[model samples]
Target chain A: MERVTVILGERSYPITIEAGLFNDPASFLPLQSGDKALIVTNSTIAPLYLDTVVKSLEKLGVNVDSVALPDGEQYKTLSVMDTVFSRLLENNHGRDTTLIALGGGVIGDLTGFSAASYQRGVRFIQVPTTLLSQVDSSVGGKTAVNHPLGKNMIGAFYQPASVVIDLNCLKTLPKRELSSGLAEVIKYGIILDADLFDWLEDNIDALMSLDEKAMGYCIRRCCEIKASVVAADEHENGVRALLNLGHTFGHAIEAEMGYGNWLHGEAVAAGMVMAAETARLLGSFEQTDVERIKRLLVRANLPVHGPESMKPEAYIPHMLRDKKTLAGKLRLVLPTAIGQSEVKGGVAHDVVLSAIGCCLI
Target chain B: MERVTVILGERSYPITIEAGLFNDPASFLPLQSGDKALIVTNSTIAPLYLDTVVKSLEKLGVNVDSVALPDGEQYKTLSVMDTVFSRLLENNHGRDTTLIALGGGVIGDLTGFSAASYQRGVRFIQVPTTLLSQVDSSVGGKTAVNHPLGKNMIGAFYQPASVVIDLNCLKTLPKRELSSGLAEVIKYGIILDADLFDWLEDNIDALMSLDEKAMGYCIRRCCEIKASVVAADEHENGVRALLNLGHTFGHAIEAEMGYGNWLHGEAVAAGMVMAAETARLLGSFEQTDVERIKRLLVRANLPVHGPESMKPEAYIPHMLRDKKTLAGKLRLVLPTAIGQSEVKGGVAHDVVLSAIGCCLI
Candidate 1:
């Protein structure tokens, strides 16, 4: 078992990474006898893992209930979350009840948000089953449902009680989803850690083959990087903005393409390339570094370019509406190097258009 | 002008009480040039005060926009809040933008929750136009939108940057609404301040007539008491729960009768009387004290009893679903004496039913 504690003062909790941890009752630490929990998964993941999680909670004498929402990122809306709220109210769940999110990013985001707003706020545990969630979404406490006008436009920075990452769940991940997860895994390397990037390059084949040791190391390093960034700036006021390296551009792609069409990680994968190209154009990042970032994403089976149908001008509107835009200036995170990035505002419109133009083919 | 600072460390904000504060640009302190603000008012308040607020911000060189929602407690749902989100996204409002709530508790709660969830979170200013909001909702950070199954079931504890309370707005308030506000004014006296209770008894007529001096002092005192309580326990982990002296019962009355039919303060008024009676049955309260509580409520023209249509047994189910309920044990706030109260869990269900029965007639 590998553990990395997200040090957020009183809001801190451990992220435990291990094979078959979901079936182990002890992995759900801090939950005691008589605790009530509602496991919120999706229709797809529920049939695969719900019973095992329920049995684990029952073994610890915790009263448990389950609600499986329909699958897909398109279903991640406020109306869908209402179903969780309805089920909770119908079951008479109260302030003391803990909401356990038992699926990928969508489930974690929806369940965490339900917990945040249910009775003002309640404790929630993140049992992320997909690699994207286990490495990124579940660890950070950013819970939200997408609004029609934007992605993650409506949400809260409510942290989970603990995060239980079961590596065994990865075996069931679709090939496309596994590659989607690698996009974020690659993100940690570009924004902060050069060594991690080199490690990925060396062990890419092993990770793709599901080699236990390599997969475990990759997940743990990403968790550690995210935990430190969150601890330094929990609300994304400062250093934490670096974690959103490709999110501004990626959100534009996700919003333009419609959520669930291009998976979040895939959009981010392409957005990261756009950011690197933007940096290269601005003379802050080398052309070789931009190519390296693209090569890695390509190796992971992720998209490295914006959708060909989406004209570079198309991303401008959505980017203008991004949450990161402050004082009417669009802020884009641009990579200065493979292991370094900075949030740059006031990048000229034509320059951004040209950068997107460069990534099209 | 009177000021009470809600000392919540980094989240601390000042509550300013004055006549015509809403129209005075200076009352909106800490807002500067180049800042953006969106005023969220209701249909009722928009005609009366929205232009003045807009002009105030414009005078400060702050970019301003306005949205008027339908008036009434029934309209304080997530759907209505979505209107605010839609406007914000359409107008390209960003994280730096401030949401100004310009109405009663409903508007404050709806707008605050909108600001809290919009783009993860944003700064909001409270320009509470009703006595209920100025004295209670606006000062605290409890922002929420009502669910069909419950009131304030979905929300967050996001605080405002500042609260601007205008006494002049009260002059336009209906007679019944004034009395509704008095219920909360009377509540502060019962739950934590004996002196305030005695003052209400002595100047009931002055308060009823909207005497400027008396109303200002009443609102200021309530804000002070609430500020202290909130500072001690911002998340309602301990002392803050006492602030909901009659809310458990009040929420039931509101839910049972349907929201907007019985005003929140009116429901709370009757619920407080029910609480006093329950404490009397428990031997911690005197029959005379309960009568005094009822007499004060009657003098303010607020209801002192639950609706005759709602049976004593009807409140039990709603009470069980209260946010205060923990581990299946219903927790309630009962007054031990005038100006004193405690949160009691495990109170016998029969005693609660009998208390509600006594208040019905």
Candidate 2:
């Protein structure tokens, strides 16, 4: 077992990575006898692992309950969240009850947000099952639900008490979802770590083949990078914006394609390529670096370009409405190099349009 | 103008109390040229003072937009907040845009929560127009919308950039609403400040008459006490719960009667009386002190007992569902005396029932 701690002062928590950790009762620490816990999982995940988690908490002598929401990203909305609130109110779950998110990103985001607003905040633990969530979303404190107008339009920066990552769960992930998760793993390399990028290039097959040793190292490195960034800027007032390197374009694609049609990491994969191209056009990034980013995404079976039918102009409106846009100026995190990125404000619309035009199939 | 600053470290903000602060451009400090602001007022307050607020911001070279929601506490729901979100999205209001809540507690809470969740947080200013709001709701960072099962069940603890209290607005306030505000004014005296309680006892007539000097001093004192409490415990881990002295019972009354039928302050007024009775039953409080508390509430024209139709048993379920309930124990803030209070956990349910029965008219 490998452990990495996110150092956020009072909000600090640990991320434990190991195979078959879900079946181990010790993975859930700080939850003691007589404590109450609610496991919020989706239908798909509930059938596979809900009982194991429930039994684990039961082994700790904690009172446990479960609510299985419908599966998928489209289900991540305010109305769906209301069901969780209803279940809580119906069962009389109070502030002391700990909510355990036992699925992938959708479950983690929704449950974390429910915990944040339920009774003006309650404790929650993140047990991310999918690779995408295990590497990225579940580690960060950004919990939100999507509005029709924007993605993550309604949310909060509420951290979880801890995150438990069981590598064995990855065995059940769909091939497409696995590829989607790789998009974010590739993203960390493109945005911050050149060495990790080289390591991915060398060990991509080992990771894809589910080699436990290789996967453990990769997950630990990604978590370490994310933890340092979050500890430095928990509110995204500065360097933390770098983490959204592909998000502005990714969000635009998700909005244009409609959420769930294009998975978040897939959109981010294509968006990262677009950002690299935008940087190349601005003379801050090289053409080779853009190709390298595209190659890794392509190798991972992820989309490296925006949808063929989505005109370059379609992204402009959504990008303009992005949370990153301030004072009508679209600020995008553009790559300056394979291992470096910076937030660029006042990027001309025509330049972005031309870059999108260049990236489309 | 008299100013009291809530010292919350980085989130600290000043509360400015004056006769006509709404029309004064200088009252809105830190908002500069080219800034965008959305003034979220209700139908009732929009006709009265929305234009003055807009004009003041415009005078400061701020590009101002306004949205008037339906009046009343019943309207403080997620759906009403959606309208505010729609206006923001339709106008392309970005994160840089500030949200200014320009009415009473409902508007302040809905708008503040909107700002807290919109784009994962934005700057907001509180222009509280009611006495309950100015002294209680606006000064603290508790922002929420009511759920059918609970009051403030869905909310966040996001603070405002500043609180601008124009005392002149109270002149147009309805007689009942004025009495509603007095409930909170009297609350500060019961929970944390004996001198403030004594002063209210001596100057109840002056405050009821909207005497500017008396109102100003009363508001300043409440803000000071609230500021100290909030500063000590921003997330209610400890001392901050003291501020909810009457809220658990008050929320029960509000939820049981259907919100807006009994004003929040009116319910709190009666709830405080019940709390005093409960304290007396527990032998920590004197009957004479409870009588004095009742007499002061009567002088302010606030309710001193539970509604005639509400049974003593009805409040138990709602109180159990309160956010304050931890580990299935109903924890309540009960007054130990006229000016001191403590959070009593594990209080017998029967004692609470008898207290309600005794307080019921």
TM-score of each: 0.99, 0.98
Report the lDDT tens digits of candidate 1 across residue range A295-322: 8899899998899889998999999988
Docking class of 1: high
Off by over 4 Å in 2: none
Candidate 1 Cα outliers beyond 4 Å, as residue runs: none
Pairs with backbone N, CA or C atoms under 3 Å apart (clashes), candidate 2: none
Tens-place lDDT digits, model 2, residues A22-75: 888889987888988889999999989998989888998989999999999899
Local error of candidate 2 at A50, Å? 0.6
The candidate that wins on TM-score is 1
**Which consecutive 10 residues in model 2 chain A have the weakest lDDT in total?**
A291-300
Enumerate the candidates' DockQ scores in order.
Answer: 0.84, 0.77
Q: Per-residue lDDT for B80-177 in model 2, tens only?
A: 88888888888999988899999999999999999998878989999999999999999889999988888888889999999999999999999999
